[model samples]
Target: MALKAAAALDVELMSTGAFSIDQLMELAGLSVSQAVYRVHPPSAGRRILVACGPGNNGGDGLVAARHLSQYGYEPTVYYPKHNKNELYQRLSKQLEDLNVPFVNDFSKALADTDHVVDAVFGFSFSGEIREPFPAVIKALEETEIPVTSVDAPSSWSIEGGPPMSGVGSNFHPAVLVSLTAPKPLVKHFKGRHFIGGRFVAPSIAAKYDFEVPRYEGVDQVVEVMPGGKALVR
Candidate 1:
């Protein structure tokens, strides 16, 4: 359902030349903030650390930080670098305008955060985490605070394999806030066991009439072959 909605929106947005990449980034950020609010209700004096990457994922984090600030939560954004990309530059400037404190170091920034928002990676990632970000991942692993990942963990793979499957234990987000539908990586990978034990697909709200149903009754059912006689006495 989430995939369908995302595809629909992608088509509509792509058709319009006016729709820019920045708009999509903002939408993703806002969606993640909403999910955070749903999972962990806002409280007084709570601190949130939003870890952003260098790409659009970082932009999403910046947007979420802005929204979180408006809700009266103190949000600190951490980005790897502020480069020349127009969208990225815009987000950096926005964060500055909002007076949101941000840093490039993962260890120091995550020191006292109550909640960690993983906007460091998105669905577009395919290979292993490179460079200093791997260090950042390692640092996040050591922290005991709850984590909320945006879309899916950065290194998760749709295709079944060693590295793909191996990453399940690496990212243990307390709640995985998917944008549209839950990605195949989120379902196939053991992320539910590790980081995001609570799987949340927020786009379902826009696509479906009823609320997303929780998994139930798997233990109560028994499979029977066609034309087989009942085993019960």
Candidate 2:
């Protein structure tokens, strides 16, 4: 219903609001970068390999790479599918402009990184894992590095928790950044879970019963503590 509610809000905004998906992508990426920085502050020359897909989730990764670069974390992007989306291209260009390298070799990327931001898939992923991604997800699972997944961990159900087989057996991420609000999968997570995207209009939020965590201080991402104490305003 989050997608439908967003569509409805887009109509309500008409031309009066910044309803573009790219604008929301920027915010999403910003939130992910901020959360990653806060959760695992980069050390001198610490590297983060952001595994991005071809969709908006990848755009989020590209955007996060840009911000992570600005924050002094050496972030490399491993975008397998470009998909040629204009917004995604623009976001990727922004990252390249910041000197973030797009490394194609997943094995090399995973080996060299201290952390991984799993933006390879979001809430809509289903079915058995495919070609390169199955291998990529496998690499992510095998690596001992901590991973901070954006939206939801890859290879998991959008409506529920982890997948029943394959890499999911070892796909426990260290941190999860749930845009807008935490998903039902949050209940199965034991690590630090954060809620981002606080710009949703009150009417939209109320209509969907989207209870979001209030961002603390100047941070745009707020940690959703256990017991569902998600500090909603």
Candidate 3:
């Protein structure tokens, strides 16, 4: 459903060649923020560290930070400096308007946070972790706080057949907010065990001709199709 909407939008925008990537980034960010609120409602004060990247993923994080600020939660965003071009500049202006704090260092920011939101990398990512991204991943792994990945866990893969090797350490999120349709790689690589612990994909808009069931109060489970039974612990 989300894919359909995104594809439609992408095609429409590409046809005109006037639409900007920032718009898509904002949509993704808003979608993630809404999912977070649904899973964990905001209170008077709670600290959330949003780990963002230099690409569209970071832009989404910026959007989430701004919305989170509006809801009265203190959100600190960490991102590496890069020439993000005009789209990012626009996002930066928006973040500045919302007064969302941005940091280039992860150590200090991670030290003082209640929860971490992994907006660093998305489905489009491939290959090995490079530079500061690896450092950020390492820092996140060291933290005891719960982490919520926007789409899939960073450094994840679904290829290379069964008995997969070299998958990253399981940083089980208290909740994972998947946009549109869930990424196939996440389920393929991590299997049901990873997602069986608090995963959610929002309901796509009605115009899209599809709907995702409301996951509210739903139990997470792994199912075996042959017997048509759910795995229980």
Candidate 4:
């Protein structure tokens, strides 16, 4: 259900012309930053390591790193597969304008940052883990630093959680921000969960028969997991 719903929602979102890729990524990234702040604020520690891939999910991470930097948090981006697309180039330029450092050593970045935002993968991810990312995911799994994954954790399936053993088995993020809606794999998640996409139209949601949790006041994100920690601001 989650995999199908996610795929359908993507199609609907793109086909309706209601939102552009930039708009969607901005909103999603903003929500991801907010979720990270709620779970691990700058006061905890200022340094943030945003691990990114080469897809839209990586774009979300790049945007989040910029927002986090504006919020007084020092963010470093670790993007292995640098995208050449104009959209991603723009995102990279934005981060570069902020003077945010982009690193190549995942282990070093992981050891240096206070928190990690796992935006290496999303709902559309499939098949076995590829180069660079397997090492990145392994580093994430071994790290003690708290992680906040954007949409879905890296290497996790949209329907199933982490694998029973091996690489992704212990790669649980401390906080998760579900974009558009919570996927079925979320049921297996054991930590704080928040819904991030605020642009989902009521008609579309109804059409899909999925509930978008009510956000508080003007907040872009809403906590869905019971007994979750309070929002920072």
Q: Which ranges of candidate 1 are over 4 A from the true structure?
A: 1-12, 16-18, 159-168, 189-233
Q: Give lDDT tens digits, candidate 4, residues 65-172.
A: 999999999999999899999999999999999999999998988888899999999978988889899999998888889999988899888888897887788888
Backbone clash tally (model 3): 0
Pairs with steric clashes in candidate 4? none
Candidate 3 structure quality by residue, lDDT tens digits, 207-230: 444334333344332222222233
Q: Give me the candidate number with maximum lDDT.
A: 4
lDDT of each: 0.61, 0.79, 0.60, 0.88
Question: Model 2, which residues run further than 4 Å from truth?
Answer: 1-18, 230-233
RMSD of candidate 4 to true structure, Å: 2.3
TM-score list, all predictions: 0.71, 0.89, 0.69, 0.94
Using TM-score as the measure, which candidate wins? 4
Instruction: Write one digit per residue (lDDT tens) for candidate 2, span 22-106.
Output: 7788888999999898778876346999999877788888889999999888999899888686777778788878888988899
Clashing pairs in 1: 2-181, 172-194, 172-195, 173-195, 173-196
Sort by TM-score, best first: what order? 4, 2, 1, 3
Pairs clashing within candidate 2:
none
Better of 1 and 2 by TM-score: 2
**Clashes in model 3: which pairs?**
none
